[model samples]
Target: MESRKHIRSFVNQTWQLRYGAPVDDATNQIIWSFIVAVLSLGAWAGAVHSGSLPVTYGRKKALLFNNVVAIVAALIMLFSRTAQSFEMILLGRFLYGYNVGLGLSVHLMYLGECSPKKLRGVMTLTGSIFIGFGKVMGQIIGIKELMGTEEMWPYLLAISGVPAVLQFVTLLFFPETPRYLYIDKGDAEGSKKALQWLWQEDNLKLELDDMQKERESTQGEKAKTVKDVLTSRCVRWQLLTLIIPCAGVQLCGINALYFYAFDIFRESGVPEDQMHYLSIGLGATELITVTLCSFLIDRAGRKKLMGYGYLLMGVTMCALTVMLSIKDLNSWVPYVNIALIFCVICIYGLGPSGVSMALPADLFLQAWRPSAYVISGTVNWLCMFLVGMLFGYIVNGLGQFCFLIFVAYTILSAAFLIYFVPETKGKTMIEIMEDFNKLNFKNRAADTEKTDVDLATQF
Candidate 1:
């Protein structure tokens, strides 16, 4: 984002002005990084509550409520200068991050359940595409030619509220997700009407049949909380599926790639002035590839796409490590490293980035879905925080060899997903669960025995 790095000097100047003297520069650096990094921490904080809010308020109302939080954050940043409190900016960023954390998690659930089986993947992946678009727009607007200047920086930061405002207004025109209506609320007629409105068709018999089966499957199951999700063994494999891949999304060095892309390009002997353009090019590549994936997902299937994405990323990292190690010995190899980095980004956008975000919704049913979101969201946010905090240290400590760590991560993640995770692209929710059942439920009789013994011990 423009505010991520470009706003640094401007914000530092404002701090100096507010203090009426020069201050320790390292303190300013730490504070600025904390303000930027705290968003993910706030996201992790909000994730624990993500699923419950949607469950309690219904998806539409929950999002509307989140929009208010975003508005509050924007107002705080807008008035931070007047109050002469840098802490306000930190508070605003945290609240903004919280809003995003909740929005990103629940929006996928809303999209997955609202869409027909055929369009579900694309609909859910639209979130990633939107994010990519936002990143590009932010970068463009944050350029020196635009609002990245000191006087306009506050407006640039405060402008984040615009999307929330628009979403709040536009989402009002949309109806509640049909699955939430039918499955969670048990409103058959209401669900049917929502489906009709959303799909613009009256014949939803086949769609409703899928919801009916899911409802039957969860017929009398009580509501589950975060504690319930953590303690349940029935969802162990499902939990792993949701977690490993989602965490893998970050561990694959996505943030590192973007955060240190300039360094990478510089090391590759790219001209200084052109490096930013090259960086922008990579961002565009991500946006375009993710957009392509959104179209291809239903046809290609999630397991194949995700598996190969990680596979390709692992393979590219292998080459990158070799290139980084050997580039000092040759003149042309830096270009090869640059190309491989681009290749990794392309593959990442194709599968891991969008697919990981959509997986929890596909992997769980109504009864366990909320808990799955909580766990998966927590993993997603935690990994994001870890990556933000530790990546610079890892890069500094390991030098060029640092990529090998990610290579190992990618290879293992790819292997697990290919062999263990099922394809959920065209499958109904019931059918996806059935596929997982075949893999995880093979030893169900033994599991039941273990469950009984454990229950007895508790008494």
Candidate 2:
């Protein structure tokens, strides 16, 4: 186990550098955000205009078509022959969203399987940093050009392909996830070879043993079927605990504050032009906070940090909401809002934003992991889309009530953590499963006791 941990750590650290080498986190974020923003425009165009491509392609063909859609949209924008319309822009954004949704799920599963218990938290947190950094980068790029400029937006959207291209090339040389090769593909020899590549002359038996244990635990269970997830009470419970809180984490309004930092600044009465520059400060603080949390998460214990972090975020968000509500507030009101925004971002970075993604991947058994992750990822993106689309409307309609929603979510999330979520720190996959199995045993005992008491009363 110790040797496996060491090997996994080395592999994870190496892959982190390799994946980020060509573009780095900031650059990747910039590219991805630009694509998302551009694709948002394309989606709008498709919905509104009659000229766009038909939307009925099959899944495999649709995915390929989507990739082509980005290229085609980019070309249309770049050539500048056709008059720019919201429809064209919307098509690009819709395509980007589809691609991102798929990519995010696959990558999360890949990262979770590749990482060992010791370094899993930091590895997952790194993905979040890249995501936030990408958003900031895209915003900075967008801020440099006029929002409606046809030339810049398409190029920015297309730039995402550069990293995707590089990733495709790099993955060609890298070994597939050993777990995938061993279990899903049923290629024992290939799995051994991949483990050797990952460990590079380290103890291969240790890694194999770890994999064997995982396989045994998951064997004979109908974990692979979607019906298993739906029908099994324990599986259903685990799925809910994993997905609901993760979705709730996003629905708490943090993304609104993060994504629309500039809008928030403008609403707080900061000059519109200056909102972009001030957003850089917000991004910097977020990066710092995420970095700190990544280092501390494995050491501090997931539950303690998450529980405390949510509490802190709730208090800060509530205070900010209250400050925003006061009539004739001091000149520092905007700055206070920014401060509270920073605090909320920081607290979330320390907890939900960084930790929640890692938890479901950790808690679900290996056989059920990919399915659980699919649900979590789907819920995450769905909630994220919901918040991103409706936050402005909510704030406009309900005003301070929006903050109250966030506070309520934070409180409920904290309550969930305190009552049910277990600390995953330093626990192996088997150990974690054993801990959960113990919970099942205890519950069964309680049920039996209750039944006996009822029987005695009847007699």
Candidate 3:
């Protein structure tokens, strides 16, 4: 879908094959938006199953299966142009969405479980780095000089399958996560071998000791369901912590900003032909910022980086609203809007983009982690769907004021991180849960006692 904006005109040109007449741009755009928005809907549906598939099949196998969906989506999309059917393209988008929903959750789970505590933040953040990289690559490939032309657009859209195929082949040799083997499957020897394979070390006593303690704490508890995550009093703060940041990822308006980038570039007097290059720059900015954050996350801590990222994003967004409002008042004002847009993306990449993805893995233990990811992935896709579908209306109705709504959301989410969510940097899962229990069990006098899944079950 990253290439959708660039390939849209080409895609619209194909509608004549179905109608036997050229469609008006208005009708074409309506259909186009549906094609784009349907991906989020599919992602939401896939996220609902993200928890169970990984829990039942294990993360590695779940991800391998997910790659097959991406392959199927690619095959369908590749033939849509030849078939002269836009419906094939729509179905392809939905399948791609489903692949992403499951991939995002299971990918995070697999990496998080495999990471040593000291390197966890950095390891998990690699996902954000790759996502940013993929966006930039999509934009680069979507350039008219490459595959964005009408004749090549279908092949460009189908390119996602190539990577899926590559991953499916390469991932077979990799070990399942040590945490999953030890804690979830109760296979101590298998876990030790996995740990050795992952870390390239013979001395894993300390690591296995930690996993044993975690396994004991979560003993007798099954992998939790999404309903359990929502309804349990034991993880109330953890759920809130996961929900707000995930929601903030969409509600913060960064995607909307990207959606409106061409308009912003137009208002700033950039040549229409040059706008795609600028879009690539925007993606590059985020990739660079997230890479920097990956290094800083463990040192500066998740809460501080996330809180400040949102706070700074709120400030940048407020400035952007003013800049957009006054663009006609001064010749240079529009350029400042462009700069502020970059700043907001940088701030988002620095904090919320990467940190939000790590929250579920950080906050929940083995039994609860799967369902926590379900909640995280669900909020993410749902909010993305709502915003993607309604943002055009919001811009038409509110104009520059649309950003103020995002500012409010960013500020509120920032405050929540600062006041409530604990920093997970360098902390063991047990330690992180204890920090959360201080808030979850704040009203109970017995909060001083050790926290366990059994206690959560008793509630």
Model 1 alpha-carbon drift over 4 Å, by segment: 1-20, 445-459
Which candidate, 2 or 3, would have the higher lDDT against the true structure?
3
Model 1 scores what on Cα lDDT? 0.83
Candidates arranged by lDDT, highest first: 3, 1, 2
Tens digits of lDDT, candidate 2, 405-452: 888887887887777766779887777777666564667878899999
lDDT of 1 at 246: 85
- Which 10-residue window in model 3 sums to the lowest lDDT? 445-454
Residue by residue across 199-263, what tens digits does model 1's lDDT show? Answer: 99988899999899989988988667777667777666778888888889889877666765677
lDDT of 3 by residue, 1-459 (tens): 335654465456576655677878788788788887889988987788889998899999999999999999999999987776788988999999999999989999999999999888888899999999999999898887888776788899899999999999989999998999999999999999999899999999988998999999989988888888899888999999889989999999897788767778898789877887998999999999999999998999999988989999999888888877777898888778888888899999999999888888888999999889888989999998888778889989998899899999999989999987878888888888889888887867363354555587799
* Model 3 segments more than 4 A misplaced: 1-20, 24-27, 446-459
Candidate 3 residue 71 Cα shift, in angstroms, is 1.0
TM-score for predicted model 2 compared with the true structure: 0.77
TM-score of each: 0.93, 0.77, 0.93
Give the alpha-carbon lDDT of every model: 0.83, 0.63, 0.88
